[model samples]
Target: MPPSDAPAPTIRPAAPADLPVLGRLGALLVRVHHDFDPLRFIPATPETERLYAGFLGTQLQEPNVVMLVAERDGEVLGYTYAGVEGNDYMALRGPAGVLYDIVVDPAHRAQGTGRMLLEATLAELAARGAPRVVLSTAERNENAQRLFARAGFRRTMIEMTREVEGDAG
Candidate 1:
């Protein structure tokens, strides 16, 4: 078992070998989101691991994407993903960065892993020339919101959804 006072994880760019653990963490992320709001997040399935592996592989090759992993004693503690993009027709702002996902293993929670990952990701996005960064967390995910706020993120928009009582179409 890892010691309670394990040293801080080393943050670095993810490699192909890290995909398996990342995929498992991705599945956990899916479960957390699905539990928090099933209507918004799809539940994880057996195929999710494979799909996430392929997706991460593609993201790794994208010039504007950043993927990082936090490892301690050769074990992955967490991972984060982000990307920079120019504002399209929908977005009024100029170039911006989007924090696509951040997931820390349950056992590593409260150990500063998530904060490290977030800071690293933000730095990478800034290095990529993004003027600002943005992300969305589930309404019930107060922990994540707090983390982002501590990292200097603020509420820029509110996403509200209402399910139609009956089919209008």
Candidate 2:
């Protein structure tokens, strides 16, 4: 039993039936990214929902992927996805896990939902034999950075991008 003041969120693997909420939350994440960097992320469009649905559906089928949802009283508060990757190239040496995406609805912020989702994902990846885990967030996304840092993830790489003025694609 949880404290009387706060309810505990149920964390579990996401199912096909959860697609609708996942799509909505995915769109919210995309919008947030776009807001953080207009040049780097695409804004929500008529096709955005469809694209997110397909992406989530495909990820759910991948054996190396872990997708989880956090819900309280049957209302989904957030979700997360991670995947195991093999290092075929010289840069990375062994099998690693990538914390691909995690999003907690704005209304549900300040709760432990994000942390719960992260811990669950990390445990799943570790159980799968991934020696290390990595994740990235938008440069301006301080909240996400803080969450990752609190989870013991350290800075390992910095990605810098510049637009070529003369190149129009």
Candidate 3:
């Protein structure tokens, strides 16, 4: 059986010092999930990774965003990002937050890293008066779906996407 009990992960908001580790974790998640879309994955280069990393770094500076990292021994094992999109769940009357992204190192799967990151995020949101939390992931990513479900999240919407060529009217 997989090791389900791991040393408690140290959770904290992302600081400038965490930029590199956050980039590494984000890139790893992208590479791992890219297998689901070869056309999108094939064109990704190291530069692309770095560029996106830089963007994430900047998001840390935005007041509307909260990017968190979980680490131990100088290695980041997980991270989660939350934001207030203004378009919150209408029925909720108090506060609202959205989980934009959450990921854990594959080596740490089933070790509660995802739960650690999520619980921490939810606490932060709750502290801020959030009554409704929301997020979206592809229906095909069953692992993520399961994680969300176990965290007490339920699907309220389905979003479909289509690609269009440039210069479409």
Candidate 4:
């Protein structure tokens, strides 16, 4: 199910009071799409809430980290968490920002909510002197891939993965 309706999100930097909602939205992320089951990625417990809360808190305190929320009518509909990373391996000449997390209420999808969150995150990072932005999503997640591409994200490389020292596969 999607959100009741599209939120006229007032994009801005998140505040302390918004922490609780930020955590909620983070949980809702895996639920937004059927393929994103948190249990499959992490242990199933309330610990996820605590982890998300801590992450949100870090975003609030880190100067190079930007946590943006899309709220309207006193409710947060979506958010994006971005962080700048300076590394010699990256394509950017200087520090580059990576969009770590982005989620819009499933009900609010296709209503510009996701776009708004990205746009705001991009702007925030740009203002902070980031040369470029990057992000990664699951290979099966076509919806998000399209959104990122539409927003000017290009395919730079493919990430190959392998499981080691696990139960015989």
Candidate 5:
């Protein structure tokens, strides 16, 4: 957490002006996940920042989506992106709110910024009448796993991946 003298970060709906920092944070998320497992996650490329920002920019117009940012004195410290999704036959899941991304700048981690963003995201989802919310975390992200658990999420699935071409026998 920040020093008692420091102002607490405020959570608010993300705006077009926040795109630059949002893109940077989004790319950081991609890099961190790729670092956890190169084979399981997509690598971050030179265009990741711009591409991510542009993609999220489209979501800004989606009525069922929520994109939020945590800021302190004009500097964005983190963001969360989520959307309410319909039932999916492929995953055998019912309608739910899916958390797509939540990232905090490295310098601001472990300081309750992530928690604040998460809480705000949950509130937004609840306000939208989400029956339930689901999210996936990199298997190696123990910190995030702990956060989710503390927020009352329980395990429901484990995804497995295989490399078909390289495993011919």
Candidate 6:
């Protein structure tokens, strides 16, 4: 949590000017996940920041997508990215809002920033007519799991992964 003396951050829609910081945060996310399981998560490369920013920039004007940032005194402390998705026959699920990413700068973590971003994102998705919202956390991300559970999300699925061996031709 931030010092009580600190002012609260404001949650608002992300802007073009925020892209550089957003890209840095996105690269942090990649590195953290890669640390958790190098084989499962993609490694952060020199171009990751630019690439991530470019990808998210494309979603800025998407009708069903929402990208938000948490700012305090003109500094962006965190951000979340989400979108409404249609039914997935493979998963046997109906339409829903899928949270793609939620990240807070390491210096700002444990300070209510993540929770604020999540609540704001959920509200945005609900306003967009999503009947339900869903997200997948890294198997090792206990902190996020706790936050999601606290926000009334109940577990519905568990994913399992296995690497393939040499070809059987």
Predicted structure with the largest TM-score when compared to the true one: 6
lDDT of each residue in 67-137, candidate 3, tens digit only? 88888767777789897556435644335688878988777677777888999998888776677788877
Model 2, span 50-81: residue lDDT tens: 78877899888899999999989888889998
What does the lDDT come to for candidate 4?
0.78
Task: Please report the TM-score between candidate 5 and the true structure.
Answer: 0.95
RMSD of 4: 3.7
For candidate 3, list the clashing residue pairs, or say none: 95-130
Show model 4 residue runs off by greater than 4 Å: 1-7, 30-40, 88-94, 165-169
Can you write out model 5's per-residue Cα lDDT over 99-123, one digit (the tens) per residue?
A: 9999999988988888999999998
Regions of model 6 farther than 4 Å from truth? 167-169
Candidate 4 lDDT over residue span 1-169, tens digit each:
3365644679988888887877777766644433454333443346655667667887798878998888877877788898988974555445688898998766567878899899989988998888998787867788999999999999986766555665775
Which digits, one per residue and each the tens of the lDDT, describe model 6 over residues 1-169? Answer: 4678998899999998999999999999999999989978999999999999999999999999999999998999999999999998888899999999999998898889999999999999999999999899999999999999999999999988887799857
Alpha carbon lDDT of residue 38, candidate 6? 91
Candidate 5 regions exceeding 4 Å error are 166-169
lDDT of 3: 0.76
What local lDDT does model 2 show for residue 168?
97
Indicate the residue-level lDDT of 53 in model 6.
93
Order the candidate numbers by lDDT, best to worst. 6, 5, 1, 2, 4, 3
Error of 3 at 52 (Å): 2.5
Clashing pairs in 5: none
Best by lDDT: 6
Give model 1's TM-score versus the native structure.
0.93
Local distance difference test, each candidate:
0.90, 0.88, 0.76, 0.78, 0.92, 0.94
C-alpha RMSD (angstroms) for model 3: 3.8
